[model samples]
Target: MKDQHINRRDFLNIVGITAATTTAALYGCAPKDQKSSGSKASSPVPTDQMTYRSFPSLGEDKVSLLGYGCMRWPTIPSPDGKGDLIDQDAVNELVDYAIAHGVNYFDTSPVYVQGWSEKATGIALSRHPRESYYLATKLSNFSNYTRENSLAMYRRSFSELQTDYLDYYLLHSIGGGEGMKTFNDRYVDNGMMDFLMKEREAGRIRRLGWSFHGSSDVFDEVLALHDKYHWDFVQIQMNYVDWRHATGRNVNGEYLYQELEKRNIPAIIMEPLLGGRLSNVPQHIMMRLKERRPEDSVASWAFRFAGSPELVLTALSGMTYMEHLQDNIRTYSPLVPLTDEDKEFLEETAQLMIKYPTIPCNDCKYCMPCPYAIDIPAVLLHYNKCVNEGNVPKSRTDENYREARRAFLVGYDRSVPKLRQADHCVGCDQCNEHCPQSIDIPKELQRIDQFVEQLKQETL
Candidate 1:
């Protein structure tokens, strides 16, 4: 925990800010009035070395290459001794630490963390000057899309974030379910898009955009609206694995980025770690990533790739703990953009991952509180883990079939409660619409459930 800050000359040179204008220009929206008492220990990461990106549309605002995604704030036991609560004190500490270390972009939504992320994020960020950071939220009107309901959600974001003007706003998780029809119902037909455009014009929403997931047709259709609506930025799932190997109804990250790039729209990247999958990769893949930069965490490879593109405004990471935040900040302190050779290596790695057949569930828990109380993410992740560990055998004649079967069954029960296991999924397809990765939750659960049953039967 070295507290030694980077030299002033180097800081100014890296950020390209002159001494006279540095304070006003760099700290315009990024200065802290006070430091948190809890983090008095010196940090290994230098505060002044953070890499930032600014575009013509952003005006004087300079956004950090690493944006804090508020979907997975840390939690603690409730004061009332009930279930867990968002550890606000901890949230404040993490936010303060991030701000001190040069992370200024905070993205949240109404639906995240069962609807508490925004309030928590707002409270932590409100401690700093509004100019100290950029606040971004979304109109998460998933179920109720009436003009009235949509407007209420939009207004509530400002209240929750404690900001009158949003630096960035989005139509959250569009292009899923019924695709364009769903998009129309959510934004177009309901006049929400018109209302948001007006809000942007009025300066309440400084940058307007959408977080996309679903059909290529809907994606193209929405991008086409850029001429009329003028999207300020777009959030898309981009990472080494998803760049060319996206599953289900999702389009490749390359295609999505190219579309936004052609439109001159900056991309705010989500899922740079592929929902934490990249961090916890298969053993061999981990070796491949480490071979290049053994000093960097496996997750840093994905972060580098996401930030390498010129059009990427920032790569959002939903870091739940301090270590995750620190590692990501270090990666982007001065992003080492991947070269042509690095890109080729990752493309090959993506092809390797495609053979594993892991479900693309990012553990977002958008499909939680399953009607049957099934733990969708837990079930899917447990299966993926076994695949990575070589504990999933394809045939009974496979050398480790007996050991693999035992390991999978034992680990499955330990990871997911028997009652909450995949067998409980009733194919209701209710979770389909909520999944950002476009995972067919019911289908995957059913398949895993069947595999578990087969393992059980083989022993008898």
Candidate 2:
């Protein structure tokens, strides 16, 4: 598989074969041939390489501006039901394609792909010389707050990534008020920050920072401490949709990016496509974008948006297939910075996007293995999808939307443990701190639970 080169036909066929099984598992439906149903894998749209953007703050690495995020690696069948394990062969090919085309940075973490990300990233990156690429991972201590656990997680990241040094290391998923306290206790009080600083001095860690998931206040508190710590770079959720949405303090009339810029910190962007939501736009949004650039893929718009600024250090996308990697490379190869008019249109679109409020989870899976066995993120994702499609009925009299609601509700119940349902949200708010969108996760879960109850009662 290392030497294999799959052509477009073979690639399409592989996608066709796996699309059914993977989509069904992801969406909780029986495998069906949906290729003929208007979701056909389109050919790679061509674009020049001059359109890509780069950030000087990152030492002028000439990154594609669009990075390859490794959280959602394509999984194969396994007994544990988490997509057996990563398909290493496919992964290697994807990485190679991205690197060959000047994508220098690859971002992974301890929890991505159920703890397989680091190992897979190691394997994929080991194929190339160390200096040829830059690697990024996070000190993901979300599950364990003790300083010991945090240190162990960092060491494990080193071992799993098969490298002695990390190009960039971040505190993963910082969110929620209480969760912020946990961060303070775990790192600030427990000497973890001092340890990371020492690691940076030892050259084991190049740049030190954190990825954000809480409100503007949380962001402010962290930045306020910056004069003391002098963080080299920070990662944040930045996308056209989230640019000024209800989450990210944008809806509350706060500007997240401006705050970062104010402090002179470079921002590593996550969720540039909003968990792939922006990759494939609805017909209406698609029409508007196409009116401007008819030949572009829906995803190109996202890369363009990210590249429009020089402040963004790197924009990450989870590329599972070679073609997906290739498409992203083409989109960013010769970056197209959005014009001022394009920026205004996107800002307006962001306003329109808020009308359909989906759970802000990026599917990072920081909140996993719900003690009660609920697939919390999966349930939220499906519900969000239904909302984005406008399949939810305003009134019970709308049978079509109502039926769609029933299908999703019944499917949710069948797919997740009853105890694990959103109703089980103990208001712990543990998941909220890790979410970059600053969603009121427990509250949203409660709302979903109530909606499910109403749907069940209606059918009765």
Candidate 3:
């Protein structure tokens, strides 16, 4: 117990703030320019030809291989000190920039950004002609299981997106054990799939598919039914890390792209950088990539890895600022597909990246409302941030970290008055089923609980 008590000074010595600050500086964390109200100011559009990737299964039109994921929108100080708005002005500018640069795809969902995603996405894309870009969203039927509820959720997407038709519509996240049960209950048992197919025939949905999270066996079953439905596209968690690792029970011992390739289904790649994990590579890996491509940014390596093949239809990245948008556009403007040597190097690097064993939470916020009121995602995020900053020891000692944990746990305790803490998960293995990243949610929570308890003892 005494050994576990890491002091602030010693922790800082191990994980230097200077390195983290340097990393942030090199990565470009500039705030985006806000658009003016009265005047229609000319925006900075890309002068170069945007790189494109074709979805032959859907159409001959080539979309910018880099699609913008409108999930993590910018937040501002709330007027009432509660929460933030969607930052529409900045979002609109990003939309404008992406469209101008030939990025024809924008992916959103009903659950993203506290349920404001569809509305914000609608407002932003409405500024441009609907035909100029393709819009992708999910069914997000996690909260609703019955056919009536599912249909309502689907219909709500149309109104929120401000569109009569959906270019690409996914079944949200499919795979995890509990998620499979929910899928069976909502779509299968309730005949939601039958309704969706009819809607597709009615032209409301141009392409129909689902995003996958776990179990390759389940993926196979879905593919087996694909011939009957002719799923136009499928989205999968396909970063360099998950390619080789066992992607939970639902993944069926196969990489997502491999499964898609087997079915000839075009794969829409999500989390190319594994939720910014790949973006903040360790110094050794960073040096390796930098040595190879001196001018390329750290993010460029991720895009390069994702853009390596022709099988991938779209690689979605959630860009919060204009510079991130610009940098991504530059990476994809003249897309450099990775060579064989590059692929080999990235594969090795990815193997090394996973060795750190950070929690697999992708910040999807599905396991939120932690009946105990815990800010599960925030806690995990802070943990990962500390790990990446090489300040895990310091993170254990820092008052700020302790405060964040305390605030989150206190909030959780208040909200979910009857629920148990992370320590009380009981290993029922219930929540793991709903997770998109296939995280052992209860296990991680227990670990955090243990650490928190240990911290308390140390302080005493």
Candidate 4:
């Protein structure tokens, strides 16, 4: 009910800017080896070489500093193309590699990868000894907040994961627009809160918490109940860029982390790479970090930032390929928490990044099939990539405009198929309601489409 929260909400409503891309690629990996999900006996990673952070609340369990985010499992193109099939064998190999490399925690939700991630994750993890690792899943009932339905979804998480009990469980995305209303219908009104808390007491749920995605007001509300709920942990979106400038609908990571820290709560960091923005930044920015550590991947810097904070229990990354998995494991296998000067340099880098008009699209695919088949995230991501590269064509008259226009157009056509490009948007708005970032999808689609048309007419 605070006016400030409402004001910020209104500002977002007016501009309708959508940010982050839904999909990302590992620049240095091949999927050929991933064609099959066969598990291999990965070489052991020395215990000292792997990073582990403990949460006293969870007892002697020391969570791996690098938690596997299971949302972006590799998929095979469905024969129909309307629905992609997860390559279960590929997923199996990835899990084996992660566990052998000392990753013990895996996080997934019911809605990830079109509800197939949990099953894929389950099959892979179940192959290993149960005591070797931990499992986490969610009650991601974004709609239909009925008790009956919520309970059914909660139970299904266990069934799909092939686990009798979950090491960690969550009330997913509790702080989007209408967060309070949704929370009430999904938890309080339906008595789901009492039911879940009881599950924790009974050990079926070893630990319980939620992932926050909106205003500080909503975050405060949940923490206020900590005395009764004893929330074992909290997941938050955090990165160097978002640590200070949350930009539109997001609660800044600084505030979110501080609040959790005040209560002695362990923080689970999400979006550390800012949906791949930090790793794929403009070359100038990349050079600043490259000058410091030429051998490290750009992603290692972001992951280290997330891990540096004393209160953070673990940082999550969605490793879709072997290269991604290997790189992250190497980074965390021995993380070097940032120094004060290092933090300052990152803060400066963030300020420079803000000048670019890149859209923040996490490519969660919450807004998909576009009702009109527009690949909304991919188009915006392509545009953002160009922006970072200083290729946003402003005029055909500019000296480098010809080169810039070609870069944007060619990248757009390649990244998104002609059939699914932004040109096809019908503006039905079905995708908006699901966007936690509250992006005005139609507006972004139109904006990008206009740019695409201009390039086409002027260049060709």
How many clashes in each candidate?
3, 15, 13, 12
TM for candidate 2 is 0.80
Give the TM-scores of the predictions, in the order they appear.
Answer: 0.87, 0.80, 0.79, 0.90
TM-score quality measure for candidate 4: 0.90
Query: Can you write out model 1's per-residue Cα lDDT over 1-460, one digit (the tens) per residue?
Result: 2132333333223221010110100101112232211121134777889999999977888999999998877655443442346666677789999999999999999887768778778777887888889989998899997999999888888888878999999999988768888899999888888788888889988998999988788899988988898888999999888898888777899999999988889999998988767776787888887777767877778899999999999999887767677778888888999999999999999899888877777767688657787767777878877887789878998999989999999987776667778888889988887887777788888888888888888852
**lDDT for model 4, on a 0 to 1 scale?**
0.79
Model 2 agreement with the true structure over 1-460: per-residue lDDT tens digits: 2323434434333322111112222111222232211121365434335344445555555545767788867656543343345666677777877777778788999877767778777877877888877899998776577888988899998887878999888987665447568678768888899999999889999888888766676777887888888888888777787776645433232276788888778778877777656754455766777676776666777777876666777788876555556656766666767889888988887776666666666666666545544566766776766666665556766758666777777667665556557877778766665555566777888888888877777752
lDDT of 4 by residue, 146-230 (tens): 8899999999988888888999898888887576887888788899999998898898999899898888888898789899889
lDDT of 3 at 382: 48
Write the residue-wise lDDT of candidate 3 on 1-460 in tens digits. 0122333334323321110000111122112453211111233435466777776687865677898887776544344433345556666677877887788999999877667778778877876777888899998877568788888889999988889999899988776546457668767889989998998999899899988775666776777788788999888777666667634443421366777787788888887777766766666777777787776777788887787667888889888766667777777777888888887887788777777757766666566445444446655654565455443444655656655555544443442222334555566665665677667887787887786576556541
Better of 1 and 3 by lDDT: 1
Off by over 4 Å in 3: 1-46, 178-181, 246-254, 369-373, 394-433, 449-460
Top candidate (lDDT): 1
Q: Best by TM-score, which number?
A: 4
Off by over 4 Å in 4: 1-23, 26-48, 80-83
